[model samples]
Target: MTNSPDILSNTFPDTPQRRLLLDFVADEADALQRGEQGGFWPDNHHLISPLIGKAGKFLDEDEHVAFFHHLLRLDHCPPVKTEEDFALLLRAYDGLGDLMSRGYPVCSLPFHLAVFLFGGDALARLPAEPEPTLASFQSGVSFLRYARSFAHMPGIMSKRQKFIDLSADRALVARVRKTLLHGHQQLLDGLGRLWLWAFVFLVLQVEEEAQPVIRKIREDAAAAGDVKRVETLERFIAAAGLAR
Candidate 1:
């Protein structure tokens, strides 16, 4: 497991390329916040693509860790102006997600934070009645599912719950519930249940509101003889002080 404090304190070596990329990220963020158009936006793909390609070529684990941390830190600037700006913010996250999905030895904490940050930005850029397309919702859910491997790690569960707390609105949560209910039956198994539980308990927050879905998941786990999953749901219910 990666030490959060160590990652936080780590910084990349001061090189011309590194300095240029960092400056571009800050400048682009400022330009976007000022609602400027067409200045360096067109150069984003050219500039960021090479960094993504070289991101994994660091000399050591410490360098690798610092690289990702630096990229994620760029997202701390002011809010973006357009979908293009949002896409720029997600470049590092998308690269990290791709790395993890390819079975790289990336730390789950940074990856999870990247996913959550990207998802928040993506949702913010959406219209009020955004379409429930797979692209629109899957990034957040997929990241939550991926983070399950580290669920037992300290602070992971609360972070998962916090992501739900931060990203969920009524329409988004309802759409997620509907998606999980209709065809994504696989999401109810194992750590997926934890994802569901977080959504139900943290996002939905009312026992009455959550009971039906919780009961269905519990019964499904029982029938499938998934004792661990059944216990997980029960513990969630008990934690919430909801009547069985």
Candidate 2:
């Protein structure tokens, strides 16, 4: 999770974009060294804090990094507190978003993650989504402004089903909600699971496919008599508005 040059070089193969990302990461790490930024924190991922040194690039690699690492394959990042912090993180993600689109052109998770991180209202107030502020990104991200983005990248196309649930992501959320539950569950970290869960319940807001999966997990917990787990699931379901 540390922002060592090694992690950057190893993550990106392209020398050009790699340099851009490395520079961005270095700036972020330096920002962390300077001081704290300010803002309201969301309950989810409202958890990470400023680190001591060049650690993990700025913030530690938390459960959220799992998705960024495994799917986009670099697999990592975190949230911000103030407008400055939000802009700093947003700038890095902009590099990530553009870096990711170097080959492909239509991915939107970078923009979506930005909105999710800064809160929809903050993004809404902007003149426009500053997502790929890079000139190379010809396509502005889909913000639900036009359509949903499937991310149409490696994880979905990996040969071995690298991320089982993620491998099912065919760039279509509805299709994902329809088919993802059928895939066998694997070792997604807590945030990974939370992201996938939220992807279904919150984004699609449909109960058809999500209900069965929720039932299966709840059933498994009940069968094992894991009272804590069952309670946790109920609380999550209720809070996420998963249950009707």
Candidate 3:
């Protein structure tokens, strides 16, 4: 993954916060290396569990962005392989999300893209049997939404577009459509509308099978008093000529 020089330079200006984040990244990298040498995998939750709150206490916006970028880069050298490795990646993604929720401008697009890619790979590698748990499916959908938010960014948009196109494959689309249609009511209440909107926007081709789902999402948004989201969904539906 190429780093944006402008983002790097702006994020790493000579500041106390910059030094602190850099030091933290260096320490985590060293720890990971040592753990690998000893044939021991570090628990991601144990590693970053405390820093969830501390990151907010110490890092400002630019520092937060720099910290996440450096930590994410660690996975590049030795790509995540095992379930434990993926858990570590998810922990890092969660840490970044925590910072962003606290008003820190942690450019989380890359991390979201990483999560989407890794999550899909993990799913594909799973043994065929009972379906993936709702929690797992929800997690994948959540990352996709985050990546979608940055679809206008350079390079990132193309990757997201690729994922969107792949997701439109007939078998996968049919499976996801069935899952969404028959999913638990509580799960639908929590993430269904957003997932529905994303699926409709990204994968579906405004065909007859897609119209009812689109209408349901629009109704859900309106009922929730999200006029802006409702309007956006309406525009997408109309633009796709899915609306009657």
Candidate 4:
């Protein structure tokens, strides 16, 4: 295949590539259920392995498609402007997040997810919105709840990760498993906080320009008696401001 697997390029993640990513997501899940010894994530160090396996490493077609395609989907993201025709970029974002939660190597995506989900002109249509719909506010709160699980999720110990994580730290990532399982609550909490800081940060990318949207989401959570959500959103607002 001439495709280099580098996302955000003119030559990658065309419709077929996008479909391939989605298909392999399901395939990984199914592969886990039946219990393949190593599952499909490449034994290679990177989350997405290279097309031609070097030395003695090997990559199956499904493993190559699912993981690399995921990166492609992530790079293009909920389609914005003259960016490749990724009209489904936000949906693509969600798919990428789902994959991360499943322990695919995320490299720096967590950081990108936290800070740049709507980078550039991705949200170009929203600057003049009259008001967020009830649905929009609800989705905001829901996303925080969805992302919160990773705060403490070890996301480790996969047979797949043990091989890779051992090097990366899932096998230790498998090793990480050994540490976390034996470690105390304080360690878990600290780890959770870092992951949450990254994971849920995307729950609300509340830059000052985006504060109105965050305010509405916070307001809705408050009115609905969601003390936890109200407090969290307030913190996100403060954190966003501080980061500046």
Identify the candidate with maximal lDDT: 1
> Where is the poorest 10-residue window by lDDT in model 1?
1-10
The runs of at least 3 residues in candidate 4 whose Cα sits more than 4 Å from the true structure, single-residue gaps closed, are: 1-38, 42-67, 70-208, 236-244
Q: Cα lDDT for residue 152, model 2?
A: 28
- Model 3, which residues run further than 4 Å from truth? 1-22, 25-168, 171-199, 206-213
Better of 1 and 2 by TM-score: 1
RMSD of each: 14.3, 16.9, 14.2, 16.6
- Give the TM-score (vs. native) of candidate 3: 0.35
Poorest lDDT segment (10 consecutive residues) of candidate 2: 37-46
lDDT tens per residue, model 4, 1-244: 1123333334333454343343444544444344321223344224333221221123233334344334433331211232222223333343344333333233223322322233211222222232323343233334333444442323311122222222331111111222222212222233234444333233223233234444544555556666765565456545434342
Candidate 3 residue-wise lDDT, 148-180, digit = tens: 465332333234455456555554444444433
Candidate 3 or 1, higher TM-score:
1
TM-score, structure 2 vs. true: 0.29
Q: Write the per-residue lDDT of candidate 2 for residues 1-244, one digit (tens) a residue.
A: 2343443334335453334344344443333234321121122122222231122343334312321322221233432333433344444443343333322222223323333333222213222223322221212222222223334222222212222343243333433333333322321112233334444333224445457656765665566666765564565555545544
Give lDDT per model, in order.
0.43, 0.35, 0.42, 0.33
TM accuracy, model 1: 0.38
Top TM-score hit = 1
Question: Which residue pairs in candidate 1 have backbone atoms (N, alpha carbon, C) closer than 3 angstroms, thus clashing?
Answer: none
